[model samples]
Target chain A: MDIIASKLFFTGIDIGSTMSKAAVVDAEGVMLGYVIGPTGAEHRRRANMVMEDVLAKCGVSLDEIAYIISTGYGRVNVPFADKQVTELTCHARGVAALFPDVRTAIDIGGQDAKVLKIKNGKLVDFLTNDKCAAGTGRFLEVAAETLGLELNEMGRISLQSDTPVKINSLCTIFAQQEIIASLSEGKPLPDILAGVYIAIATRVVKLARQLKVEPPVVFTGGVAKNGGMVKAIEAVLGMPVSVPPEPLITGCLGAAILARDEAFKLINRGEYKLQKKQLSEAYIEFTEKTR
Target chain B: MSGYYLGIDIGSVGSKAVVIDGSRIISSAVIPSGTNYATTSAAVKAEVLKLAGLKEGDITASAATGIGGRNAGAGSYHSVILCDARGVNLTFPAARSIIDIGGQGSQLTSINETGQVIDFSVSEICATGSARLLQVVARILQIGIEEIGPLSMKAVRPSNFSTSCTVFLETEVITRISQGDKPADILAGIHRSIAEKISGMARGVALNPEVAVIGGGALDIGLILAIEEKLGMKALVPENPRIIAALGAALIARG
Candidate 1:
C-alpha cells in the first residue's frame, strides 16, 4: 500500500480563455478524474481551483502529483506547472491518444479555431484562426444571445430546420442585424439558428481545407459538444468525425500524458529529485520530429 | 411652374426621405429602417411631405438610392455611389473624394471637379467598419451609439484594437472590458480600428483633396477625427450627414 501511494501520478491543467480544466492520470496513462470550471478574470486562481477539485475527486493530495503540466492560453500562469505546452500540441497529442487513426483534428474554442493535420499520432501541420473569432464558440454564443436561446440548446433547435435562412454577413455584428431582420420577416427561429450553424461550419471548413485534411478526423474542444455544429461540419466535410467522450478536457489530457511520459523517463534516468521545470529536451525533440 | 422633387434612400439601418423644390431643400425625415423596407420608405415619405406642408402628388419626380432603394416603390433608382457623389458636391463643390460609410457596407469614391464619379471601391464582404459595428459595440457597452463619438474624444490613451473583423472585435472588446479599460479608451480604439479599415478600402480609390465624408457613419465625430488622422487630411461633413444621400437622390430626381 505504501509503495502504491508513492507511485507517480501525473496531472495536467489547461487554462483556456473561457474555461479551465484539470485532468489526473496514473502511471499507465489511465484518467483518474477530471474537473472543469469557468475561467474568470483571475486565471491563476481558477487554475488552482480546478486542480484542487480534480485532485480531491481523485482522492490525491497536491504533494502526490508527481508532475504537473499546463497548456492553453494561460498555460504560463499556472503557479505549480512543471511544464508549459502549446494548446495546438496538447490537442494533437490528446486526440491521438483517443483515436490513433485520426489524421486531422478540428478544435473550435471560445475565441479561436484550429485545424491540425496528423500523421501516425504526430502533428504534421496545423492552422489557427487567432486573428478573429468568426467561427468560434463565441460566435455561437452571440447568435444564441440574439435568439434568446441557451448555448446548449442551439444544436437541437438548429437541427429542426428544414431550410436554413441565408446569413449573408460574415461580420458578427452585421450577422446579428441580419438575424433581427429575419425574425421580423417572420422567419422561424430554427431556420435562423440553422443559418448560424451553417455559417460557422462554412468558415471552419474553409480553414480546415487549407491543409490536406483527410478522413478519420477528430473534433475536440468545447464546441465539439454542439451536435448541430458537428452535423454541419460533417456535412461540409462530407465525412464522419470522431469526438472524444470528454472533448473539452483533451488539452488537459494531453498534458497529463506528457507528464506521465516525463515521469517515466526521469525514473529510468535514476533522477529521483523531481523539480518543477520547463519542457525537457526529449519532449521538444519529440514534438519537433513529429512536425 | 415650380415643382417639388422627392428622393428616398432606404438603407439597411435607416431610411431617409427628402423633398426639394427646384433649387433648395424643403423638408427631410430620417427614421429607423425596421424589417419592412417598403413600410419605412412610405413612412419617411409621408413624414417629409407633412414637414414640407405639401401633398405627395405635389412632387414632380422621385428617385431612390441605397440597398433597399429598388424596393422603395420610387419612379427611378440611382446607384448609391452616384448619389453620394452628387450630394457631397452639392455641399462642398470642390470635393474630389467621398467616403460613405453606411449601416451594412462602405464605399470610397473618387470624383472629378464636376462631382462625376471617376473611380470607386466598396467593402467586399464584411461590415466591420460600418455603422452597424458601432451600434453593436454601443449595445455591448450599454451606451447610446450617439454617445460613443463624444465619449471617445476624452480618451487620453486609446487602446489598440488589432482585428477589423467584427466577430473578433467583440471578443477583444470583452477582454478589454474585463481588463478594466476605460469605456472612452475602448471607444477610441474602436474608432481607430474603423478608420484603419476604411483607410485600407480607400487605398484602392484615387483619393484627392477636399475629401467629403458622408452617410450615417459620418455622425461619429471621433471616427471623423480618426479618419483625418489616418488619411492625414481634413474632411468636410454636412450638418446632417445621414441626409446627404437622400438629398443627392432628390437632385437626380430634379434632373
Candidate 2:
C-alpha cells in the first residue's frame, strides 16, 4: 500500500561488526539514499531499523523495493533479506561500480582487514589478517584512546609530521604500551600518529603483496576515510590508491546494486513475484532456529 | 662474602628487587611499575633494602633483568629467558621447560640440566599471551588482582572467547558482561586463552618433561588449573613466583 507506484527500488542492508548500513537504489542502479548506524548488541533488530530509516530517507517504502539483500559479518542475522551475500563480494561490486578499472580493493573493517583481488568487477583472490588485530581499524581506535585524541584528529595531525617513528609491537595492546613510553620520552604527537598509520599500512600491505597486487587499487571501509591511512598505504605500497565517496556505505551500495540486477533478471524472464515479506514470521523463525 | 648480592627486575607491569646471600633469598620487594623505569626501580630497591635491614651501599654486586632491566643501576643485565631458566633450575631442578607470563610478554623457555637456555619463544606477535590482559580485566571487573584467579575456579563452564587480540577481546569481554555472562566464566576463559598462547608459542621446540610455570602467570591458581588441563600435566611453581627472575639475577650476581 505504501508503494511509490511509478518506480521500482532495490534495498541492501549491511550488518557489519561495528556498524549497520542500508542503501536504496532505483531500477537504473542510482543510489537514492543510505543510512549507517551503530550495530549495537542486537544485530537483527538493528538491521531492520536501518532498512526502515534508509527507505524513509529515500521517500520509498519497503513495498516499493523489488528485492532486498544483506551483506557483511552479520549478514546471516538479517531475516528479512531475500538473499545474503558476503561483504567481500558486495565490496567488489560496489568498487567496480565506482572505479571501473579497479584491479585490487582493500577493505579494513573494525574486526578485520581484507585485500581483495578484483577482475572485471568480480572477486578473484583475497587475503585477510589471520586472527590478528595488527592491521585493522581497531588498532587506530586503540591509538586514539592512548593519545587521548579523537579518531579524526589522527589523520589531520599525522599530516604535519615529516618524520614518523616506527612502532615495534604488532599487537594493539602492546602498541599502547609503546605509545605511552613514546609520550613519556617527549615524542611529538604527529610523529606517533604517523607511525601508527604506517604500522597499519605495513601490516595490510604485507597481506596485499601476497595477493600480487595490481594497479588501480581502490580502498574502502570506514578506515579509508582517514586521509593519513590512504597516504600511509600509498607510501608503503609504492602506488597511489583511490577511494569512493561515502566509504562506509560501499557494502550496502553493492548489495543494493545486486538486488537491482537480480530483480531485473526476474522481470526479464517474466518470473517476477512480489515478495511476501513477513517480518514477524521471519523473526519467529530466527528465534526458533536459534533456540 | 658476608654481604649481599642484589637482583632487580624492571618489568612493564611491576618491578621487583631481590637481596640474596649466595643463592639464599634474604629479602625481595615488588611494586607496581606505573609508567616508566626510574620510579618503579627506585621504590622496589628501597623496599628490598628495607626488608633486608640494609642500605643501597650494603649490596656487593647487583644484576638486572626483564624489559626495563637496563635502568636498574645494576652492575650487569641479563636476558629474561636466561634468568627464567636459571631460576627454574634452582626452584625445580627437574624443570626443563618454563612459561613466564610477564606484564608486557609471555615467554616460554627450554632449558638444559644446568639451567642453560636451549631455546626460547616469546609470544612475538601480540600481548594476548601476556599477563597485562589480566590487569585490564581486573580493572574492568572492579576486582582486586588477587581475586581473579580464585574467582575463576567457580565457573561452571568457562565462556568461549574466540579472539585473543586484547583490543578485540576487551570489547568482547565488555559485551559478555553486558550479555549477563558470569565474571567467573569469563575469567576462566581468559586463563585458558593465556594457557593456549603459551602452548602455541612452544610449537617448534619439543618441551621436555617436568615443565614449570613461573613469573606473574604462575601466581594465579585458576590459570595454573586451566594450564594444567590444557597441557595435561602438573606444572611446577616456586614459593614466590614473581621474584624468580630477580632471584636468578641475584644468583648470577653472587657468582
**Which prediction has the highest lDDT against the true structure?**
1
> Against the true chain A, what TM-score does chain A of candidate 1 give?
0.91
Against the unseen true structure, what C-alpha lDDT does each candidate score?
0.85, 0.84
lDDT of 2 by residue, B144-167 (tens): 889999999999888888777776
Candidate 2 vs. truth: CA RMSD? 6.5
Error of 1 at B188 (Å): 3.9
At residue A48, what lDDT does model 1 achieve? 81
**Error in Å for residue B128 of model 2:** 6.1
**What is the CA-based DockQ of model 1?**
0.26
lDDT of 2 by residue, A1-291 (tens): 113213678898998878899999887888998999987766778888998899889998776677899998788878888899988889888888888899999999887899989999888988887577778998898789767789987899999898898898867877877876776566898998999999999999999999999999999999999999999999999999998888888899999999889866755554554343433333233223433
- Per-prediction TM-score: 0.76, 0.75
